[model samples]
Target: MKPPPFSYHRAGSGEHAVALLSALGPRAKVLAGGQSLLPMLNLRLADPPHLVDIGRAEDLRILRRAGDRLVIGAATTQSEVEYSSLTAAVPLLAEAVGYVAHPPIRHRGTVVGSMAHAAAVAELPCVALVLDARFTVLGADGVRTVAAGDFFLGPFRTAVGPGELVAEVALPIAAPGTGQAWSEFSLRRGNFPVAGAGVSLTLHHGRVAAVAIGLSGVADRPVRVPSAERILLGAVPDDELITRAAAAATEDLEPRPAADPAAHILPVPVAPVPGFDYRARVARSQVRRALTTALARAGGTR
Candidate 1:
C-alpha cells in the first residue's frame, strides 16, 4: 500500500519543525524515525496532507544527562538509548528497549516516536509509565512538559496537540537499591507481545520501600498498577505477599471487548486478546514473575 498524496516539508531543526507545524496546522505530520509514521501512512491510517521531516534536526538529536533526569531527544533512536552510557540511569528503560523488536527496527525507531505512536500494547510507552518519564513539547505557544501518566491517552494517541511536537523525553535516575525487570509473552522474539510487564522495585531492610508496575497488552494504554504497588509497600516480598500483589494487579486490567480485542491497535494487529478471566490470570502471573525477579535483584529473599 502507498501513502496518500501529501506535500513534504523539511525542517532543518526542532524549532524549524515546530514552525512548519504551526503553519500547516494539524494537517501536517512530523517525520522523525518514520518507522511508525511511514507504516501508518502506507496503511492510510494517517492521512495528513503535509509531511514535516525532522531528520536533519541536529539539536533534537541530543542524548545527555540534565541533572537527575536522563534526557533523550525526539530523534534519538532506540539503538542509541540501548547502547549509550546514559542508559545506566534508567535500567528499566534500557532493559525494555531490548525487547522492542529486532536490532534493525531499534536502529531506526525513535524512542520518543514509539512512545507517541504506542499505547500500552508496546514496550516503550509501558516503560515510560514505569519510569515516570516526562515529555517536552514545543509549539508556537511555547514549551510544556507532560508526564508519562498524562501523556499516553491511548494507542497512537498522546498529549501532544496538533501544532506541538514532542522534542525530548526525560527519565528520572533510579535510586540506590532499585532493581528493574521486564517480561513479555510472545511466541517469538520481536513479535508484538501478547502481554508484558515492566517492574521497578526498591527494597530496604528486606521490605519494599518503593515500586512501580507497568503493564502492557492488558488495556487500551500502558498503565501503572498502583493497587499492586500498594500491596508490596513496606512489606517483605515473599511468596504470600507476591501472590497477593499479583492478584491485586489483576483488579486494574480492563480487557478489550470480546468481539474484537485486536482492534485496539487499528491498522496494526496485536496478539488476540484473551477472555477476561484469561487476561486477568495472565496479568496476575506476569506481575508475580516480574516482582519475584525484581525482589531478587534488589537483594531480597523470595
Candidate 2:
C-alpha cells in the first residue's frame, strides 16, 4: 500500500514542532518514531497534508526526575524508558516496558507516541492509568496537564487538540509498602495481549491498603475495575475473594465470538461486536491470573 502525498518538515525543537502543527492545523500530523503512524500511512488510513518530523528534537528524548515525581519526555523511546535508572524506581512500569513488543520494536517505539496513539489494546497506557499518570501537553495556550484516565478517550484517539503536542508524562512516587504487578495473555509470543491487567497495591498494618486495577483489550478504553479494587481493600487475598474480584473486573465486558460464521466451526467462542460476553469471560480468566500473581508479589495475604 502507498500513502497519499504530503509535505514534510523536521523541527529543531519541541516548541518549533508545536508552532508548525498549530500553523498547519488539521492537515498536519506529527511524526515521532513512526511506529504506529507510518503503518496508518502505508494503509492510506491517514492522508494528512503535511508530516512534521520531530525525531531530532533533543529535548523530547530525555528522562528526568523532578522532586517526588518521575518525568518522561514524550519522544522517549520504549527501550530508553525500560532501561532508565529512574524507571527502575517504578517496577511496574519497568516490567511492563520489558514486555512491550520485541527488542527491535522497542528500540524505535517512543512511549509518548504509544500513549498519544491511544491504542486501547496497549499495555503501558493501562499501567499509566493504574499509576494515575499525568500527561503534559503544549499548545498555543501554553501547557496543561491531563490525567491518564482522562487523556485516553477512545481507540487510537486522545484529548490532544489539533495543534497540541504531548510534551511529557508525570508519575507520582509510590507510597511505602506498595507493590505492583503487570501480566497479560497473548496468543503468541510478543503479540499484544488478548487481555491484561496491571495491579498496584499498598500494604498497611498487615491488611490490604490501596488497590488499583487497570485492564486492557477488554473494552474500548483501558478500564479501572474499582469494584474489584474495593473488594481487595482492607480484606485478605483468598481464592474466593480473587474469584469475586475477577468477576467484577470483567463484569462490564461483552465478549462476542468471531465474526466469520465459519469461524464457529473452529470450536471457539464467537459472537458479534467483539463478543462482549465471551471477551468478558476471557477477561475474567486473565484477571484471576493477574490478581494471583499480584498478591504473591505483595507477600501473599498479610
Candidate 3:
C-alpha cells in the first residue's frame, strides 16, 4: 500500500529542518535516509502529514573526531561510517554495522535513523548502549544531549520529542588497552538477529578493569547487563568466570513473544525457536562468545 498523502519539504540546513519540524509539530517527520521511515510508511504503520527532508543538510552529514569522541552527524549513512577509517576509534561500531541489513540498505540507512527507530533487535543501538554514546537533539528552543542509555524508552520510541530532531551522535573513543566484540544469531545474512550481544573490555594488569555488556533481541529495548559486568570486574578472564557472567546476563531476561504466528512471511520467517527458555539460552551463548572475543582482543586468556 502507498503511504498517505503528505507534504514534502527539503531542508536547506540542520536549523532549517528543526524549524520545519517545529512549525509542523508532531505531524511532521524528518527524512534522513528514508530507509526506516519509508518502509513504515509503505506498511501504513506511520502516516506523517509532512516530511522534512534533511538529506541535503551538509551540517548533518559530518563525520569526524571531537576531543576524545567520534562525532557522527545524524544524516551520515551507515555504509559511509562502516567503510571509513574513523570507525577505528570505535571498533565495536564498525563490527556491529556489518549486521545491519545488506549493503544497499546500509548505503542509504542513517546511523541516527537506526537509533531513533529503536528497533528491539537492531545492532546499532546495542553497540551505542555498550559504548555509552551521546545523542544531540535539535529543537526550536535549543539543543540538548541525551545519553544513549536514557535515549531509548521502548520499541520504536525514543527521547526525541515533538518538534525535535536528532542532530548528531557522539561515541567516546575507546581508551588504550580496551577491546570490543559483537556477536549475533541472525537467521539470514541481512535479517534481524534472534539474540545479539556486544562487549567492551578494558584490561588492567591482566584483570578486567572495566567492562560493558549490551544485549538485544531478548528484550523490549537494547539493554546493558551491569549485573554481569559486576561479575567480571577485577577478575581474571577464565572459562568458569565467563560462564558465570553469561548466566548472570541472561538469568533475569524475559524473552519477547514471537511475531504473529499467522503472518506467513517468507525470507522474513516467523520465530519458531521455541519460547523464553530457548531465547535465553541463545542470549547466554552470545554473551559468552562476545566476552571471550573481547577478552582475547584485550590481551587476556580464557
> Over 4 Å off in model 3, which ranges?
259-274
- Segments in model 2 whose C-alpha atoms lie over 4 Å from true places: 254-274
lDDT, candidate 1, 1-302, per-residue tens: 98999999988889999999999988788888888788778888789999898877888898999999999998889999999988988888888899887999899889998897875568888999998999999999999999998998876678898988999999999888988888877658996666788899998888889999988877777889999999899988898988888889868666566444332444455335555566556667888888888888888888
Q: List the residue pairs that clash in candidate 1.
A: 120-222
Q: Quote the lDDT for 38 in model 3.
A: 86
Q: Residue pairs in steric clash, candidate 3?
A: none
State candidate 3's TM-score: 0.94
Model 3 Cα lDDT, one tens digit per residue, 15-123: 9999999888788999989987887787776789999999889999989999999999988999999999998889899899999999999999999988988887788
lDDT of 2 by residue, 1-302 (tens): 87889999998888999999988886799898888787778767778999898888998887888877888887789999998888976767887887777898888888888788776667888888989999999988899999998998866668998988898888877667777778886666776666678888777775778888988777666889988888889987788998999889876554534452211211122222244455566667877877777676767762
lDDT sort, best first: 3, 1, 2
N/CA/C clash count, model 3:
0
**lDDT, each prediction:** 0.83, 0.78, 0.86
Candidate 1's C-alpha runs over 4 A off are 258-276
